[model samples]
Target chain A: MKEATTSKIAWGWLALAAVFLVYPLVFQSAFFRDIGVLLLLAAISASAWNIVGGYAGQVSVGHGMFFGVGAYVPLMVFTHLGWPPLLGVPIAIVVVLVLSVIVGMPTFRLQGHYFSMATLAVAELIRLLVGTWDFAGAAIGLSGPAIPRGWWDLTFTSELPYYYIFLGVLATLLLVTWQVQRSRFGYYMRAVKAGERAAKSLGVPVRRTKLFALMLSAAFTSIAGSLYAIKTGFVDPESGFGILVSVQMLIIAALGGAGTLIGPLIGAIILIPLQTATNTWFGGGGSGLTYILYGGIIVLLARFEPGGLVELWNTYAPRRWRSGSHAP
Target chain B: MLLEAKNVAKHFGEFRAVADANLTVAEGDVIGLIGPNGAGKSTFFNCLAGDTEPTAGTILFDGQDVTNASTETHARLGIGRTFQVPATFEDMTILENVMVGAFMRHPGRADARAHAEKIIEMTGLREHAHLRARSLGTPGRKRLEIARVLATGPRLMLLDEALAGLTPGELQQAITLVRRIHETGVTLVIVEHIMEVIMTLTARVLVFNQGHVIASGKPQDVVKDPLVIEAYLGHGHGKRARKRGPAA
Candidate 1:
């Protein structure tokens, strides 16, 4: 039965990849391409956050710490030493993986609101430190060195390249999340999230599972950050490590369905379009309306449908069509 | 001994909850643990299940020291238990709740599911297999709790008030099921306020009073002891106790 499910999922991905490959070719436009890239990046980041916040029931508002570090470390290294973004990305990932442990060791002990607040405080501290610290270009931020227009540089002259890169990254992250959801570690995480006491009673190594989730979540979010920096070609303390960035990631996870595999993608689908439409209509005043819209959606969803859009679909839709159809 | 607790004690602040308790259970033994409220029966059970660490003494399971082990470790070591209040995975189905226990022994979900089906059938919860555990009635939930623990392949089962709030018919069925479970060679330690169920199910009994064991012997003998009757009926009712039949 697992073999059947795996084969079915593989076929589903094959179908999705076919659509992803053909869509850009048929409807090529710079604006659409840019939106696609942003949506993909948001999906990747939200999915990464879901591993810990959604699946493991650990809400973290310090994801920007990893994102900021992921963006800056590679760009900073490249700016000073002339290394390529390709090499810098992996280096950034490794750095964040190490940083996750340092941060997680203290914060994971705290549960619920305390954990969320602690993570937010740590993220805020990082933002403040980045703004004031001289080594990280001190608030002014750092830009990557100039590179010729080439595939190897990961720098392109157009949105098309970024769209494809992000699409690939988004696909990879989604696949990773799916794999994790099916693994023994994923079961441990779910057990912990259900009830720490019960999971411990069942012999689940709760702390170890949480640490693993946090580290994996940080690693993926860091990769998204590195990619964001590369695509944008510039980064600042506010833009990279802002509290709003963390909130946005969490909102995406919440709106999509948190623990579900496709939740972040669903969240990105709704949020990115809404943000783009608001920006087009309201212009500079649109930012406030965007928050109002997001807040309203969150409140309405949380109040009426705490499980988010994925849960709503599961409740109403036919289960046979879904990718993963485990018994309740 | 299949499970043993040696001089176990627990304290909350300055108050002693369970003091210097010793217990032993061999394979296929059905031991009834009885006491009034605040006698530390629940606390003692918690210590044995590793939900709360004993401040002093040791626990041995299948010959290894498991004193400070987590509840999960105890579970994996075939020490399955049911909570007094039926603590289940509420969001999951009744079958899924059982599957979680089954998963303790079977790593694969398919195998766990197969095992859970059998347990659910045994508990007579086949009709409610897909229903959420929270939706079940009290007796149904108790049965689900029992099934959940039984799915874990436990050699020793700890049941806390498993028959606390059951209809007489349900109680009879539960007793029969417990006997059947014992017939499968699983040792049972039952903490029950229902004297009739305890008398019918247990071969031996241990009485607790004020956080101490006051009596231990065959159920018929232990219940007839003066201290056991006084503990149950209160000191003032000692003269009136003669009007009632023997304690058993």
Candidate 2:
């Protein structure tokens, strides 16, 4: 039984990997390819957020701070130090690590809603600081310097390179998720999520587990931020550190089914396209309509299927596949 | 010594929950701690288990001072406890619930699962191994709680109201399980309102009233003590004192 389950999971990964590898080849339309890039980035961010939000049950609404830092560090380095955005990747991750710990020291100890609020405040603080700072281009934000397009500089004109880059990023994050799911750390996170007191009693080291999860989450989120900034070549304070970005990540993870390994990817696949389609077709002038439609979908999902689409599928999916996605 | 608490006191705001309570238990001893509803039995247990630090005093476990230790620290130091209310991870399967505890000692998943399986079998939860904990009945939940803690390989186990909601058949089985755990050479401190189980299971009984230990000794002798009778039957002089059972 165990061998069968392991083989099934291996096949699941192989099948998904095969699909992603050939997706760009099969889908020739540049528009669809761009959408694929957006979906992959969203999935990466949401999957990163899931480490803390889904597994540790620490719903953070301030992850945009990490995302913002990820974008700003590389952009600043490129503009000021004349280095590629790739150079800031490690620095952004390190900075976010320290920030997450500082924020998590007090907030991780707080209960659910309060923890979420604390994160929101942290993101807002970063946004306000960046908005006023002249060195980081102030409220206008930093624009990637016009440099020679190359893999080393992480700059490219076509969407295909970015599509593959982000696909690779998503793959790494998914691999991390898979390892965590099968390891002792994954079990501890689930225990903490299920019952903190019970987890503590069982020697799960609740605080430390939460902090570790937050660090891993922040690191991945910063990577996503950097990649997103490089692709766009521009990142304003509002675009980088906005609450909307954090909300979207939260919605993607939760709407997919929080604790499941593939939930975030599934959520991004559905929500990103739906969002783009809605904005293109129904959007008359501004974002109000798009937001209202998005809000309504979120409300409906929360009301009718709080476990999200993955859970809905799990109930009806094959028994062999059902055991592979252990939902919290 | 397995455990010792010196002048331990726990206060929630102005209200004192456990007041200057001192206790000592030798290795491999089954000790019973009994008190009325608000007599601070659970509070004292929490202090010992490191769920809540005492407002004042020191707790020594396995010869290490652990007064300010976190619950995880206590757990790592081989002090395991159960809540008065069943506290299983409702989303996890019965086997997974126990395996979480086993994971503390055994870092490998397969080893933890193997150890947990044995515990589940011993606790008579083998039949329900794959069932989610939320689907369990009262007795099953209670046993599952014990199975989880037992998997932690605790040298000293504190059970708070383990037999609270069991049927007569379930109660007998639970009593046997407790005995089995004790026979494994784990020191035990049990908090039980059921006097019969306490009397049979514990070698010594400590009576608590208003956050203080009023008496401690052999169970039969403690039950016959006039002060214990008053504490249980009330201080008012009554002709019905002799007729009242301690648990009743």
Candidate 3:
């Protein structure tokens, strides 16, 4: 049975890989590849958010702080020092680690919706602060390298390279998430999510586990932000630290299945295309629709099925496949 | 002694949940705490299990002081416990529920899974290993509580009314399961509402009345203590106590 499961998983991954491999070649359009890149980026960010919100149940709505810094630092560094924007990725990760600790310490100390509220508050605070900071380009924001100085500069006219790059990053993030799912820490994360008191009784270090999860999540979210800047060649306080920026990751993760491995990816698959389509059809006016769509799904899912699409998939999928998506 | 709680009192603001609790548990000895409703049996149990810190007291586990230690620290120091409400990870399967505890010692997923499987089998929950914990009723969840605690490889285990709502047959099975676990050399401290369980399972009994150890001795003698009768069993409970058979 174990061998069969293993083989099935391998096949699943190969199939997933095949889709990514074939998409660009078949579509052969910049628009499609841009959508692909955006979808993967959203998936990466959502997956990172899942480490804290989904797997560990921290439910942070302020991940835009990590993402904003990630997007901002690289571009801001380039604008200030004329250095390669990619160099700021590591700096962004370190900054996110410190920020996560600062955020996690106080919020994790108090259980329940406090973490979510604190995250939302922090993200907005950062946005407001960034809106005034002249060094980091203030509300106007910063731009990436004006022109590619070298191959390392990562500036590209084609969306294809960004698509592959994002796919690689998303794959890496998924791999890490899978490791967490199967590891001892992953088990602890679920235990912590179940109930802090029960988790404590079961020998799970609840507070510490949450802190670590937030840090891990923050780091990846920062990386995703950096990637966004690298691709877009620009960053503004509104784009970098916007509430919608933070909320999108949460919405996608919740829509798919908050804690499941492929939940964010599935959510990205469904939500991103719809998002791109509406934005294209409506031009700049699609932002309001996105909010309405997100709010509607959140309310409906919260009331009807907080377990999200993954739970539905688990219950409705073939008997053999039901065991694959373990919901927690 | 494997465990000791000296003058432990839990006060929530001005109201004292447990006024004073002193208990010592020797290694390999099984003990029971029985009390009338609101006599603070569960509260004292929580104090002993490190679920709640006492307002004033010291707790020694395996000769080390751990009065203010967190619940995880207690577990790491070879102590494990079950909640009165039968706490189980709702979204997890029975096997995964046990595996979470097994991870305390096993650390590796495969090892934890193996240990959890063995625990599930021992607890007679093998058939339900893959079923979500939320699907379980009270008795099943109580059994899961035991399975999860047992998976932690504890030297001492505390059970809080684990058999409270079980049917007669389920109670018998649960008693047998606890006996089987006792035979494995883990010391046990249980809070129980059932007299039959106390008489059959515990080596000694501590009778609580209004947050105090009003009476304590072998189950047969302790039940007859006048203070225990007046406080717990009410006025004329001695005759009924006498009718019950000796400890098993």
Clashes of each: 5, 0, 0
The better candidate by lDDT, 2 or 3, is 3
Error of 1 at A61 (Å): 1.6
Enumerate the chain B TM-scores of all models. Answer: 0.94, 0.95, 0.93
> By lDDT, highest first, what's the ranking?
3, 2, 1
**Per-candidate DockQ vs. reference:** 0.37, 0.54, 0.58
User: Which number leads on TM-score?
Assistant: 3
Model 3 residue runs over 4 Å out of place are A1-6, A324-328, B233-248
Query: Model 1 compared with the native: what TM-score?
Result: 0.90
Model 1, stretches more than 4 Å misplaced?
A: A1-19, A316-328, B93-96, B108-137, B242-248
Report the C-alpha lDDT of model 2 over A1-328, residue by residue, as the tens digit.
6578778878987998899888889997988888889999999999999999988888899999999999999999998998888899999999999999999898777666887889999899989999999999999999886776666786776789999989999998988898997688998998999999989999998888999999999999999999999889889898899988898898999889898888899999888998888777766675776567558768988788877887777667877667642432
Q: Model 3 residue B137 lDDT?
A: 90
Instruction: Name the best candidate (by DockQ).
Output: 3
CA displacement after TM-score superposition, residue A275 of candidate 2 (Å): 0.5
lDDT of 1 at A247: 81
In model 1, what are the clashing residue pairs, if there are any?
Answer: A200-B72, A201-B71, A201-B72, A202-B72, A203-B72
Candidate 1, residues A250-302, lDDT tens digits: the string is 99989989988778888998899888989988999767886787789878987
Error of 3 at A249 (Å): 0.2
From the highest TM-score down, the ranking of the candidates is: 3, 2, 1
Q: What share of the true interface contacts does each candidate keep?
A: 0.26, 0.65, 0.68
